[model samples]
Target: MSTDPRLFIDAPLSASAAIPLAREDAHYLINVMRRGEGDVVRVFNGRDGEWSAVIAHASRKGAGLTVADQTRPQQGVPDLWLMFAPVRRSKTELIVEKATELGAAVIAPVVTERTQSDRIKFERLQAITKEAAEQTERLDLPELRTSEKLAAVLDNWPDDRLLIFCDESGDEADAAWGGARGRGQPMAAALAGAGDRPAAILIGPEGGFSPAERDRLRSLQHVVPVTLGPRILRAETAAIAALTIWQSTCGDWR
Candidate 1:
């Protein structure tokens, strides 16, 4: 399996489609991977399913692969989104990678009162997600959205979609938020009967949501607040944990 490389192409994919590799991919395939003509590999675009392709042509500057047949048809996961406040650069990257692996349909950066940075390098994040999708054998890549204020996102919230809010201050015994999920409300219980309903998991920054922000989220009609556990988790850890819990209960993993 290691011999057969799986690559992600940004263009539409179909049988006999000539995929032109970028300079870096060309270098990796030819020099690093040490592949010759007639080698077979798998390729996919977010829009297209995975396909079997062969190296029809190779060169120093570039190599062209010919798409053969569809290995897996295009499939989408549960309409789950990850709305997180951006943290430090490396931790933010970790959140993106894990979210992709854990099956988030969309990844949007939300700016809360305690958000550390507003700048999001989509190019770098896109590359990381594509690499992660390829490595994790995911058919589709998670959509990345620009950073937006929490208030803006809430004001524009859709009526049909459910927002799973991870409030650090939530209590298992608290009457609010239906109590700690997976214990009182439980993550699975909060998501019960919500199959195919547009849902999102929101994680705040390291400093957590501000008092006003917490009140605002709690007051939202469509928001479902839940707790991770008794222990406090970092921003990145909470993001991954929330996605995993969602997938296991209501996403593709189920």
Candidate 2:
């Protein structure tokens, strides 16, 4: 593990470039981390490769770092997206952070019929992803799409990409647990046949999707419904589990 601080510098990074640190980052390095002039750190922009940098100037007012040679070439995550209904603020942030660490290329909040928290703080979530990416050594941050209704997203979903629906509930009222039979194939089995197409995982809210929402999702040809397991998982757990399964089965982890 590297002890040097890693930062996501949004500027164009190149050899011999002197990039000024953002105020919060400056405070973190100078005041928080107690780093000073000539101290080395690592930096990366989504477009440029990772680079080693030396703090050229550090002060309470600001700090700057001079870019050194590239350390690693730019690499992108596999084309996998995570679309989950937002839960409580803390849990929602956890989903975003963990999704970034797990290498989701895009993070989208989808509002379902039973979604508890329809609103999202995009700026705050973006910060969480940036920090997560920095800590995880991801070459780039996941693209955080604005929250959208599940219906609209489904309507606009591209044909080339597949949507994996983490369906935990079904519409059969008389059936056990409202229809465990509604549970699609086990996630690993469904993903094993998903081929190499780009994919997204959709996790519903705590209350799960409304019957209409479930029906609509099931109606989609490109949607592959799957179950996490026999046990019911919390919204956050479901998101993490779904992402993990997808990555292991159909993404870069393979």
Candidate 3:
């Protein structure tokens, strides 16, 4: 792994712009990383892309950087969203981290009958996504939305966005939702039909969606029910698998 550190900042970055580091960031660079004046570090704001900046000084409990050159141009990833029912703390973190690394444009948490009542730690999740994006070379952080009821979300979903629902029990769903009748329709088949349309993936919690929730999802005109494979997967595993397949099929990986 590259030892050079990369950081996400809220300030604007332009050639010759001297960006002041926050106290926390200065501590990390000056103390944790043991960086000093003239050291090279990479930085990016979600909108500005990434740039190479040199440390201007190692001051009393703070530091500054002089923006040097653009390392990368601002670019957008495939317009893909990952909507999932929050799982246990660790698994939920796993989903967020993997989703960011895999290039999800948005991370939305949905509440279903099967989802636990406990609230997600939004602040921590944001930190996790930021760290994951930095580690994985993502130029932008995925947009994180607050948790919302699944019904309200479905009711107000944009008509142009296709929702690929990862139905764990696709074989057991009714025809209206494209269940067993759509048995041969794997996720790949769904994406093949999606073309360049804006898309989102919805994964249920560990116990899976309730019967009513499944029925409702199936009845949505824009929603496509898909199977990962013959084997059942943990919620986090399904999230990772679905993202990989989506990216390979029609995402930026193409």
**Top candidate (lDDT):** 2
lDDT (10s digit) by residue, model 2, range 1-254: 67899999999998889999999899888887888999999999998989999999987678899999899999999999999999999999999999999999999999998888988999999999999999999999999999999999998999989989987764442153355435688899988867578999999988878878877887789998888877878989999999898888888888
For residue 130, what is the lDDT in candidate 3? Answer: 84
The per-candidate count of clashes, in order, stands at 3, 0, 0
List model 1 lDDT by residue over 14-132, tens digit each.
99999888776777777877887899888888778999999888976679899999998988767889999999899999999998888788999999998989889989999899889
**Candidates ranked by TM-score:** 2, 3, 1
Greater lDDT among 1 and 3 belongs to: 3
Q: Which stretches of candidate 3 lie over 4 Å from their true place?
A: 1-3, 170-184
Q: Which TM-score value belongs to model 2?
A: 0.95
Per-model lDDT: 0.83, 0.89, 0.87
What are the clashing pairs of model 3?
A: none
- List ranges where model 2 is wrong by over 4 Å: 170-182
- Provide the TM-score for each candidate, comma-separated: 0.91, 0.95, 0.92
Off by over 4 Å in 1: 1-3, 170-184
Candidate 3 versus truth, CA RMSD in Å, comes to 2.3
Candidate numbers, best lDDT first, in rank order: 2, 3, 1
**RMSD to true structure for each model, in Å:** 3.1, 2.0, 2.3
